[model samples]
Each structure stands twice: as structure tokens, then as C-alpha cells.
Target: MPCRTNEELQNLVEEAKREAPAGKVADYIPALEKANSSDLSAAIFYPDGTCYSAGDIKDQFTLQSISKVISLALALMDRGEEKVFSLVGQEPTGDPFNSIVKLESHSPNKPLNPMINAGALAVTHLIAGVDVTERLERLLCFIQDLTGNHSITYNKDIAESEFETAFLNRALCYFMKQHCVIDEDVEELMNLYTKQCAIEMNSLDLARMGCVLAMDGVDPLNGRQLIPFHIARICKTFMVTCGMYNASGEFAIKVGIPAKSGVSGGVMGAVPGRFGIGIYGPALDEKGNSIAGLKLLDIMSKKYSLSMF
Candidate 1:
């Protein structure tokens, strides 16, 4: 792999920011409604250990669905593959991320995949500690190790906001419980899920986290093994199949990498053996993805030939 200097990568982010206004910011979350629709930022870590970043890369944002990947990875490490797979499927549902139709209609009522809230909630239940607190601590430890940053912590305001307006998620939890798919207390599991989503960090932290997945579950900069290779491969596969909510197919065609997006206007793309890319633009498209972030990845992937395909 050729070396990409910080300046060149920064230039890509600026060029991509020009497309920010092409979409709107996500407003359903209420707290996320205040974000500037045109905000754009990107951080990329190359194989040769260079970090390039530009725009609002330093702005703090919640992980939202991006936490799903981390939680699932932890669950895999704790329970291994068979148990996790039994609770969640790998197939992509073209349906909405929060769709309950399959849960009601399927025989066992398991979630379609780990990337969705349903699957992620299931994965979270399998986190395998005595309580939710321990599980969350484990998750935080994994994230801190992956990022090589110990200062990361959850944003209480964001967690409270989601907890206040998470009727849909609560209902989903009940549905899973009704089917006996979730064995733990619904309140505990949901609380853990919400907090995981609310853990705050900027693009630099996310890029470093992505570095773990990009390096096949090892931190490239420090060579720390945060997750098993199988777990990383599974998470990356899910990202490619279902990470962008309903836009996964289109994104795969355009960016051609295993990527995940969250309602908080964050996107993490893991380019195997090359780098982990993170983007933050509070503005979102209909699919709840950072609109400007997607455009930025499309632009960078094309320019640098970073597509996994």
C-alpha cells in the first residue's frame, strides 16, 4: 500500500464536505435535531500508520447504531459464534432497521441480523456477565483498548434522551421477551443498549476503533488484539450486508466497503488491511445515515481505490 499523507487525506475530506447540504439532519431523535445539517468531517488511517482528518472531526457524537457492532463483537468474544448465531441471523432484511414484521411473522421471532436494533439487543443480552453494569464496563474496556484511548465515556444526556423516547425499542424488547428469545430482564438489557449507543466520541476515536476491525480485530497502531478474527469477520460481513439501514445495497455499490452508520450522524467504514475510516456529519438522509458522511466515503473510495470489492 502506498503512503497517504495527512494533507492529502485532509484534502479529500474538504472536497467531500462540499456535498453536505445535499441532505438533511436526522430529527426524529429530538436531541439530534439541533445538529447543523451541513456539518461534515472525516478521518482516515492508512496502512502505513498515517492519520488524515478534516472538517468537524473533533466534534463529539453518540455511537447510536454504531455501538451495535461493538456490542456484537463483545458478545462473540464472551459467548463465541454458535450461541450468538443462534440468537441472531446474518441475512439482510430490506425492511427498515426497526421493522417488527419479521419478528411477529417468523417462527422463532429472532432478529434478522446483529446490525439491526433487534439483533443488537439480542446480542447485548448475550454479553455474559453477572449484570448489565459489568457488561457495559467490558464493552467500554474493549472500546478504549481498540481506540488506544482511555478517556472515552458515555454521554448521560444522550442516553437519557434516548431512554425517554425509546418506546419503539421498548416495544421491540417486549416482543422478543414474548417469544422467549431474550432470557434477561428487558429493562436491564435495554438500558445497557441505550447506554452503549450513547457512549460519546469523535471521528478520531471512531477511526481508531475502526482501525481494530480494519486490522481484523487488532489495533494496527499498537497491535492490540481486541476481538477474535472470526468475530471481526462476522461484524464486517454484517456491516456490508446491513449496516446502512435500508441503504446498505446502494452504499455497497458506491463505497464498496463494510461500513456501519448510526442515527447520530456517524459512519465507520472498515477497509481490510488498509485503514478504518470514520465520518461525522450530523446531517442525515432518509435512511438515518450521515448524508455528508456517505458522500465523503464515496468520494474518497473512488479517488483512492479503497473499495473492498
Candidate 2:
């Protein structure tokens, strides 16, 4: 296949937008249900210092589960890898994101990995922030540093809505507590986790953040060390193994890179020093991944040979 030029890539994106299926937007949260199903945006950051974008590249959307990658990296940096692993496993559960069967089926019931809601809540519990305000401050500061964008903040409305409907996550946190996996208060843990997921970002900002992980924790635009190399490696590994809820396996087989997707219609891909991709499409498959976003990634990965493995 011939390589696609920037102009051709832009055209391909437009064409995808036109034919993309309008899958279900997450309805558990009323706000997410209000998102435009046809909205699609994509941005790519290449290692050679070039950037390409099309569609609603500048449109802002909630990070949702995409924030998991960020907080997991932060927790790893704040604590050592071994310590973090003690609380969260690295294996993919092959279960639904919010499934509770594994917790009771296995001894100790530790979460299978940090990419799931259970694992993510465990990671958030490990953060040193003593309270919700402190945790949000640290998270915001890290986002600002990583993106070089000071305007990033949580969408309070989204946070409130998730908090209202977070029964499953709340139960997961309590289970972790019962199993002695987390030491923090359960409500505090929920607040920190929910607020992190509520962080607002557009495709371009997320692409830049993904670039940090792609560059092995170094912020390419400023050369600042946002996360340690080992931390970045572990986060990428988890993303590859367990990022897309139950659909993670298929995505790894098809896209062949470490990527994470959110219910808010955002997907972040890290190419391990080659490039980072950010795409948003509010409609999701049954497993809570962006349908159009996945299609776009599949096409681009095949065209550019962007898979890490």
C-alpha cells in the first residue's frame, strides 16, 4: 500500500466521519448521553516533530477512563513499581470492566490490573493526597505539566453525575477495602477517582499527553521528565493487555499498540517513541470503547505500520 500523504489522511478522516456508525453513547451518565454521536476528531504527533489533525481536533471532551493511564503513571512515580504491583495485578481479567466475579472467585480478590475500574480505584487509593482537594490539585498540576496547558480542569458536572451513579465503582472500592487492598477511606477514594476521570481535554491536548508516554515519560515539547521510564513501560504494558474493557484483546490484535479508551468517547494511543494518537467519538460499543475511534485507529495503524509489537 502506498503511504498516505497528510492531505490524503485528512480526507480519509473526513470520509470515516461520514460513514462511521453512531453507536451508543454511555447512558449511565446523563451528560454522556447528550454528547453528539457523530462527533469525530483525530490528531497525531509524529517523532519527527510533525503533527496532523482533522475533524473536531480542537473540540474538548471528558477524559473518562483515559484518565486511568495518567493516574496509574502518577501512582507509580509516587510509589515504586513493586509496591504498586502488590496492590494491583498486571494480568488482564478478560472480564467486563465492572465485573465483580473475579473479586470473589479468587483468593485475596485483588484487582487483575490497573486498567479496570477495580484496579484504577486501587491505584487512586495509593496516591498520597490526603483529601479530595489535595488529590485534585496534584492531578491538575500533573496534567498542566504534561500538556503545557494550564487551562485543563475537571468538568464538575461530569464529576457530580458520575458520583451519583457510581454504585458499582463504590462497591468495588469497598471490596478492595474489605480485602485490605486499599488503606484510604472509601468515599475519599471514590472522589479522587471520579474527579480524575472528569478531567476535561480535547484531542490535541490528549495527543500531547500521550506523546509523553510515547517518548518514555519525557515531555517531547519541553524535555521535562513527567514520568519515569520504568513507569511508562509498565503503564504501556497494561494498556496493551487490558485497556479496552473486555474488548482489549481484539484491539491489541487489530491495532497492535498500547492504547486506552474512555466512555466519554476518547481514545489515547502510545506508539513507544514513534508517535501518539488521540481520537474522540462519543458513540461506544457494548464494551464501552469508542466505535468510530477504534475504526480510525485500525485504518491509521495499518496504513502507517504504527503497531509497537
Candidate 3:
């Protein structure tokens, strides 16, 4: 097959947006309720340092659940694999990302995986910091360093808004604490996690972030080993198995790439030694994934034979 040119990618993005129904935008958070339901964008960074983008590629969105990917890697760097896995299992829950069933009924009360809300909160609690602000700052610095965007920062409005309406998350953390799974105070850890979720970035930023993992933890732009190879491997493994929430298995079979999605309509994928991609389509499905973005990745993956399997 011929190489995918920029025009073809742009055409594909437009096609994907047309397929995006007027789906529901996340309104549970007052801040997220403001997203334009019609917005769609995508960007990719290849190992050669070229960036390809289409649609609303320059538009910004909060990291939302995608922040878990970076936070998980940092957690491994901070807490190490043994301590991290002891608190959160490395398996899919088959329930909603925020479901409380497995956390309650499962043995040891560990979260099913780090991609879920419960697991993310517990993982955030393990990052060492003097205070909530320090912990959040550390996360921000880590992402900025990897993305090479010094100006990257959080959307405090979203963080505060999500915090105010974070009833379910609060309940989950409280339960984990009671079960001896979480180490930090519930409110403090929630603040850290919320702030991390509120970190804003465009598709290019996400593509760059994914590119670091594409190189197995080394930032290609600078040649720095931002994360250990083993740590990046673990993060990518979870992304493949549980990153798309309940649709992960289907995505694996169809798209066959290591990817993570966030409720803010963002998807991040790393193509091992080849490329890193980011997609955004605010219209989400019942499963909370970007419906159009998923379709776009499936098409691109098939067209280029990007599937690992």
C-alpha cells in the first residue's frame, strides 16, 4: 500500500466527523458541559519529527481520563511496580470505568485496573508529595516535560467544577480507604487527581506525549529517558487491555493498537517504534468513548495495516 498522505488523512478526518452523530456531551461535570458537541480533530507524530493534523486539531480540551495514562507511568516511577500492583490489579473490570461493584465485591478490594476511576485515585495517592498542590504540580511538570510544552497548564475551572460534583469518586475513594487500599487522605488525593484531569492540551500535545511512549519512555525530541522501558511497557499493556473501558477487547481486535481514551473526547495511541497519534471527537457513545474518534482510528489502522496483531 502507498503511504498515507496529509490530504488523505484530512479527508478521513472529515469523513469521520460526518459519521459523528449529535451524541451526548459529558454534562455531569459543569465544566465539561460546555464542550462543542460537533468538534472533531486528530494529530499524529511520526519518528521522523513530522506532525500531521486535521479538523479542529488546534482546539484544546482537558485531559479527563487520559490523564490516567501519564499518572500511571509516574506512579510506577514513584511507587514501583510491586507496591503499585499490590493496590490495583492489572485486569479489566467489564463494568463502567466508575463502577463500584468490583471494588466492593472483589477480593483484597483492589481496583480492577489503573485505567478505572477507583484505580486512578489509588494510584494518584501513591505519588509522593509534600501536599496536594505539590503532587499536582509534579504531574503537570512530568507531562510538560514529555510533551516539550512549557506553557501547558491545568484548567482550574474544570478541576474545581469536577471536584464539586465528584460525589461518586469521593465515595469510591472513601471505600478504598476503609479497605486499606488507599494511603492518602481522600480529599487530598481527589484534589490531585482532579487537577491532573484538568490539564489542558491540544492534539499536537497529546501526539507528542504518545510519541514518548512510542519510543519506549525516551522523549525522541530530546533523547531523555523520561520513563523506564519496563514502566512504559506496563502502561501500554494496560492501555491495550482496559484503556477503552468496556469496549477495549473489541478495539483491540479491530484497531489492534495500544490506546487510551478520555471522557473529554481524546484518544492517545502509540505505534511502538513508528508513530504516536491523538484523536478528539466530543460526541461520545453510551460507553463514554469518542464515537467518531474510534471509527477514525479503526479506519486509519486498517488502511495502513497499523494493527500489531
Can you write out model 1's per-residue Cα lDDT over 195-285, one digit (the tens) per residue? Answer: 9999988998888788789889987766667788888998999999899998999999998999999988899989888788888988777
- What's model 1's overall lDDT? 0.84
* Every model's TM-score: 0.95, 0.95, 0.97
> Looking at model 3, which ten-residue stretch has the lowest summed lDDT?
1-10
> Evaluated with lDDT, which candidate comes out highest?
3
> What are the lDDT figures for the candidates, one per model?
0.84, 0.84, 0.89
Q: How close is candidate 2 to the true structure, as a TM-score?
A: 0.95
The residue pairs that clash in candidate 1, if any, are none
**Candidate 1 residue-wise lDDT at 238:** 90
Model 2 spans > 4 angstroms off = 1-6
lDDT of 1 at 218: 81
The residue ranges of model 1 lying beyond 4 angstroms of the native Cα positions read 1-3
TM-score of 1: 0.95
